[model samples]
Target chain A: MPSATMLPITDVSACCTNVTRETISAENAELLARSLKALADPARLRLISIVAASEGAEACVCDLTEPLGLSQPTVSHHLKVLVDAGYLEREKRGTWAYYRLTPGSLDAVSSLLATV
Target chain B: MPSATMLPITDVSACCTNVTRETISAENAELLARSLKALADPARLRLISIVAASEGAEACVCDLTEPLGLSQPTVSHHLKVLVDAGYLEREKRGTWAYYRLTPGSLDAVSSLLATV
Candidate 1:
């Protein structure tokens, strides 16, 4: 397993001026695709919408579970997938887990779709 | 299995404000996800990039195969997938098939990714 405290190096080169400014490389495409895949599911889409429309652009596991009409674990599972893909960041406060949309994640995707 | 000359109906109501202005539905999300899935591959990414950089933002099957480092049949297959997904429109000119990025396809996707 990878070390717990070490930040990922792959992420450093994986930001802006990438998929937008330059022709997206295959490697970058895969990464971006994986991120997009997180939003690929309808359940995930509603999750994003529910959270996005929430105050402060954030939501917790408790608020999310009921609206999605799925089991808690399933909701958590999807949230984890979103977080793993870098779309959402997770913050654990006591018994609750707060999920917030990361800045620039959606914009990068937006820029990629922008026609010249 | 379906007859030709009768264009697809799915393309309608599948456009603007679908992924952007409205909260994406499960069915629509699936459709868009499948479309995005077609672009999820690296070869397809390169193919799109190459085509975008081409004059008139279009390319033939011949211009794509070599750069993609894939067999002709494989390249053709990817183009078909793009066409089927509504991302690229196909026109068979003589013995060659010319593929052009469909209007508003990229922009609708861009709009969806746009935050606020």
Candidate 2:
């Protein structure tokens, strides 16, 4: 069953069979690749981790710049890619933009790699 | 708990907390990123999936070229990256090389992305 935290995934299959269970279709492979590509960078992963681990599982653009030790623009760029990839959710709050983990997004991709 | 299928991961933390649970260190993020980078390609994911689904959870370079719709050299290159990343294992089989999922390698990574 799909977890309650799982959001609607447009490009990839939901609860799709993983690599261990059966051969994945090419289309599904492409979608999965796109999602994984967004997470392929160390900077992006750090950004995600920071936001995910932040209080309320969310963080503001202002707060992320310091711990990430990256330029504001660079952090924003990574966040944008993550949002576009559907792994994150972005919201505007006053002068800053807040990003949050998109519920089951990471879990969905993780499950795809399951070998058991 | 780490599954029996999970293999030993040298670079990253074992049963380490994910981003959802806490902020990840840069070093861990880099290691995770490297692992994810290896799986960020459609061809690679397809390759992994195909190998995992094959009988005995293994495949030869010869059998992979056709379904992947890529040249032998291309397939071989991707396989090498996966092996280096520790997701797949390569073994000599007389005339050809057989590749198989490295037991817990994929699951260890999948567990890393767990949000719950």
Candidate 3:
């Protein structure tokens, strides 16, 4: 019997299969797609790129704001979306918050996209 | 001077940079993210997976609909989105339209995602 918590996640992933011969349930597909949608914006993409290209592959809000030419609040909003998507991690140092790539997050997406 | 026809697409891609030292223009970021968005749906994700894993890396709409458990029209719509995004190529064979992966489209996305 399937547990209650596990079922919904599986259900979302169950709707589809991976590119591999192994079938990917639609439930898995849903989850994967949701994550992808999070990075679907140009602002978010640039944010990821900027952070990845940063001196430490991490950065704070002030660094992003001027480069993006967007307001602080807007940059904050986009950063929130990235955090929600698992593509980034935000850490606060005193009054400032810094964001960095979550390591394998990109690879997870890449493998999900890979055909072999 | 920028051409009238090129500005909109350029504007969209203008918000991003690649994680490399080389810099990815925001214009490129917008174009890349939109393409990513097209694949962000499970229906579309499965569609790409199926085609990529197909015998000739090609399949028709009919082959896709049943596996996806979606209406033909819905499957058609997703395929059209993929086609519009340059992920899949549609070919007409008599009364039916077949969709196949366009060479390098996936890699284009991968490179955009690549940070080094």
Candidate 4:
């Protein structure tokens, strides 16, 4: 079952196959494409990097705007997208939300692409 | 220098960094995003898998249409996108065009994502 974040790639990867090993089903292709679409943007990719490189592989939403050179709302929007796509996990502490790389999520997608 | 195919991700990776190691530059983010955009479509993903799973990791354009259940032009367009993004290499043999995975291209992108 998918978490509340609804990671479609995680659901699809349960089958343990990759594009290069066999022809993927349309359903799996759609799900994987959705995840790729989430990461296919410049801002989102940058956001992921910033969060990953930060201490503890996490960063406060408050700290994201300056490095991305984007406004707070825009950075929040990208953060939301990453959270929704299951690449990042979000937790609230006091006045701010912090984001961290969801362990192995990137590697799962990486394995898919490398085999292709 | 970029190839005629203009693999921007390859050009960017020449800098010898992955996103997790540091904040990626805006220009590098843009180029990587462009390559990911080419791969963010379901049809294109399926097209790549079919081609990769074919003999010698290559497939003739003639053999692609049926498995994809897409028209020739539609499949051709997706292939063109993959070729332009440097994910696939196109070759002409007599009357038919063949496509094969460009060596190390997917792995390059994979390395970036996994490290992030």
For all the predictions, what are the DockQ values? 0.48, 0.69, 0.46, 0.71
Poorest lDDT segment (10 consecutive residues) of candidate 2 chain B: B1-10
User: Over the stretch B47-77, how does candidate 1's per-residue lDDT look in tens digits?
Assistant: 7767777777788999999877899999988
Task: Identify the superior model by lDDT, candidate 1 or candidate 4.
Answer: 4
Q: Weakest 10 consecutive residues, lDDT, candidate 1 chain A?
A: A1-10
Each model's interface RMSD (Å)?
Answer: 2.6, 1.2, 2.3, 1.6
Q: Candidate 1 on A11-110: residue-level lDDT in tens?
A: 5234523333356665665555655566667688777767776777789999988877899999989987777766678888898888887776676666
Q: Model 2, DockQ value?
A: 0.69
lDDT of 3 by residue, B1-116 (tens): 22332232223333434444444567676676777888789788778777777778789888988999999999998887777776788899998898988765665565446544
Docking class of 1: acceptable
Candidate 1 or 2, higher lDDT? Answer: 2
The C-alpha local distance difference test score for the whole of candidate 2 amounts to: 0.78
Q: What residue pairs are clashing in model 1?
A: none
Clashes of each: 0, 3, 25, 0
* True A-B contacts kept by model 1: 0.49
**lDDT tens per residue, model 4, A1-116:** 24533465555566537777788898778888878998899999999888888988889987888878899999888888878777889989999889998887788887888864
Q: Evaluate residue A36 in candidate 2 and report its C-alpha lDDT on the 0 to 100 scale.
A: 83
Q: Model 3 TM-score?
A: 0.79
Structure candidate 4, residue pairs in collision: none
> After aligning candidate 4 to the native by TM-score, how far in Å is the CA of B27 from where it should be?
1.1
- On TM-score, the leading prediction is 4
